[model samples]
Target: MKEYIVTKHAIQRAVERLGQTEQHAPHHLKQLMQTAFYQGETPGPNGFIRKFYDHFKTKTRLVVIGEKIITVYKFPEAVPIPFADEVAQVIKRKFAKSERDFKRKERALSIEIAEFNVELAQHRLSYAKAKSPKVRESLSDKISELETKVGRIQFELDEAIKAFNAIKEGAAKYL
Candidate 1:
């Protein structure tokens, strides 16, 4: 793994440009620098590298020389992108919609499981109160069937939740 060192001057510059306090600047700057070093694209020549970061709604640029962060400053102007922002917005909306759909499905499955449990409980009560053996046997079968339904629905809910979590993890990188 490549390690990039964050200098005191870079931290101070990030604190000033990004409106972060001195106390929290070092850690935050280090994290941002590390992320930039790994994830950010270098826009300049091989010897010169610039990393653009958005911090506190302010676009900033970090100057890195080899393994040392030389300084950080507010970006003077917007980086030109004709349709990249629009495409990103569309992709974000799609992710949001998928997340909402998964949540809705999970809720629906949970409600269904609860309703099955309630029906099972009612059947159990009926079984206990019945006097005839025929009715008791029938109720016992019904309760077993309801329990199976509940178990199946519960498994589905668990799978849906796992899928939702996976989507969230995948979306975090972009959003």
Candidate 2:
């Protein structure tokens, strides 16, 4: 997390540049206050504009300068917050609404995996039924094909799991 800070060095530099505290106060102090007093969405919330967000904050700190509340503005610092987890299911569910593109894909992949498993079972049964060299060879080939398809599906599943975990961890760190 980063913090907004105006150090002693910065004040000293400002004083040196302006040559007089009174002169600096009249010219720049008001502008700085106006900038800081703004109540609106910052860059932190990406969906700030989309939703009905009504969070308001007031930042007022007293400074002992000529015995007055000289409103000051400093650049803000930012830190990220985790909005949600279970992002994998969220993405898959989003596919339901926007199904024109990927609905067929989702169905096809599931169907293919189911068919692959059924074919593997059927081939094993055939090998048991016909105890011959050619039958065994054919069953072996079919089993190999099913295994390949399952391997591909396994790789895709691993990737999805990794992506989900990475997103969770990365969002935990920062946005």
Candidate 3:
């Protein structure tokens, strides 16, 4: 996220230019920058003139010194959202959330796989030691069922990884 400081002079000018009171100007300016759609920039000596459109659709130009806002001027025209970084934050946040969910699922699946392995081993031991054919057959059936479940879980884990990787890659491209 872009960081900036609001100066006293900037606050005064914003009040004057925006026709706002002293109490409202600083608060309003901060809100505008937070949700502002960045328009364009003009480079200058210490910083640049960063343009933006507030939530109210008011066109605003900020004179920035270093990371501080030095002054503000309001224009009559409306500015549209054009910054990729703005959309990038939303996309990145969505993917990050998805990634967390996928990772959680992957962990759960891994634990299930381990549990299945233990069950399969127990069934294998029972089958080997069983004197009766029926007992051996029952153990065999259970082992097969557990194997199928394990396979399904593995497939799902693979798909989740693929999705997480795809999102990561796609987000990186925009960044």
Candidate 4:
């Protein structure tokens, strides 16, 4: 329902680029401008609003400033880049492998840490029940060693998780 002032330049461009006759250019341009507005416009450089309309097998790009139609021209078709699909597939595979490796390492480290915790618990129980100070000290040493091993494995798991997250973030840019 908004009014638009169709400029002579816009009519001229439609006549030249869209093959419309000079007599009919204004009407045709007005119709295309309406269609473009209905479809919505994207903000262009230098305060221009750019819109596109496909009519009778022709794709037209309309440029406007405020409510004035500035220019009308054909929208160019995109050309496909060579090997783009192959490159995408390769990148996807690399990220998948990295994710799987991280998960596998995490699972293994988690299992090892769990086992060490069970051993530590058993050593603590034995230390509590033992009468001799020597036996209790020995059990205490074993518990400390197991705890150290568990800490080291947990650190490795954390590092693997960090590395996997970095790879995931890097892969997002490409895919």
Candidate 5:
């Protein structure tokens, strides 16, 4: 078992804060050590002071001087933030809508790319069977243009999908 050497100043402070007497101070200090949740640390005159919150949300600051508890006191007027959960819900909804929009754009781009591929294939068949050089050249140019369009659309679709994935990852942290 770990033993804590409680300081005299710490006892007086705890007694004054809890409206208790000197005799009750040791029990109060024991309870504070047992039930407190670690809040954080603060800079003290000597060094760093460790802070904790008890069951009633009372902030207790204790400084460790060697093996002893140096100073213990309640930090003044700490309050929990309001509407944190509600703000999180609002952010989740906004990110969901953003994900949906990106997915929709990706679907539209994919459909356009599929159509361009089909058109390019048909133009290639026409270019192969054309009797005149002029008709074959025209069909070849059309096929090239369609191919470029398909490539651009496919690139845009990939970008949109990447955006959706990024949004999903970001929203997971909050929601």
Candidate 6:
């Protein structure tokens, strides 16, 4: 038993060192695989894979930028736990990209709304400055257009806020 334990430790160190340049993150998850296998349960690749995700998730990053750019767990893989961990890393990267996309969309939405409001204000000023009835009427139509755009963006922002809240709540489970 002692020799087995020693061998496992040695293998873990060796593997970690071997992967150093490729991945700075330590393989703390390997410990769980070692303990479970040492007990003779003979966990197969799939079982060890589960432990790997759970371990890697808790020790490292599990929650990736899920579907909507919020942090969520990576997908499960069929390989060993280490494989799952690698997948989790990929998920994390995907999450980052998704998060950036979401932020970009949000910022664009905000800017659009701001621009609409500014247009509305400008139209109102134009309506006031109009010297002729036809020009005032035209300004009124433009103001109405701006108002409609503002309403549409407001609805979209509200929906996004709801989605963000749900994602935030769901993220609490992983943390």
Candidate with top TM-score is 4
Mind giving the per-residue lDDT tens digits that candidate 1 earns over 1-175?
4566778898788777878888887666666654453336475766576654444344556666677776887757767678877877987888899888998998899889989988999999999999999999999999999999998999888988888788878777655
Locate the minimum summed-lDDT window of 10 residues in model 4.
Answer: 49-58
Best-matching candidate per lDDT = 4
By TM-score, the better pick of 2 and 4 is: 4
Residues 62-175 of candidate 3: C-alpha lDDT, one tens digit per residue:
655567777888765556559866898988788889888988999999999999999999999999999999998999999999999999989998998998898889888876
Give Cα distance to truth, residue 99, candidate 6, Å: 2.9
Candidate 2, residues 65-166, lDDT tens digits: the string is 222222233324455435544564565565444444344555666777787888889888887888789889988888888899888986765665565566
Give the Cα lDDT of each candidate: 0.77, 0.50, 0.80, 0.82, 0.74, 0.52
Position 27, candidate 6: lDDT = 38
Q: In candidate 3, how many Å is residue 42 off? A: 36
TM-score of each: 0.51, 0.38, 0.52, 0.55, 0.54, 0.45
- State the TM-score for model 2: 0.38
Say which prediction, candidate 3 or candidate 6, comes out ahead on lDDT: 3
Model 1's alpha-carbon lDDT is 0.77
Regions more than 4 Å wrong, model 5:
1-81
Q: Worst ten-residue run, lDDT, model 3?
A: 47-56
Worst 10 residues of 5 by lDDT: 48-57
Cα RMSD for candidate 3? 11.7
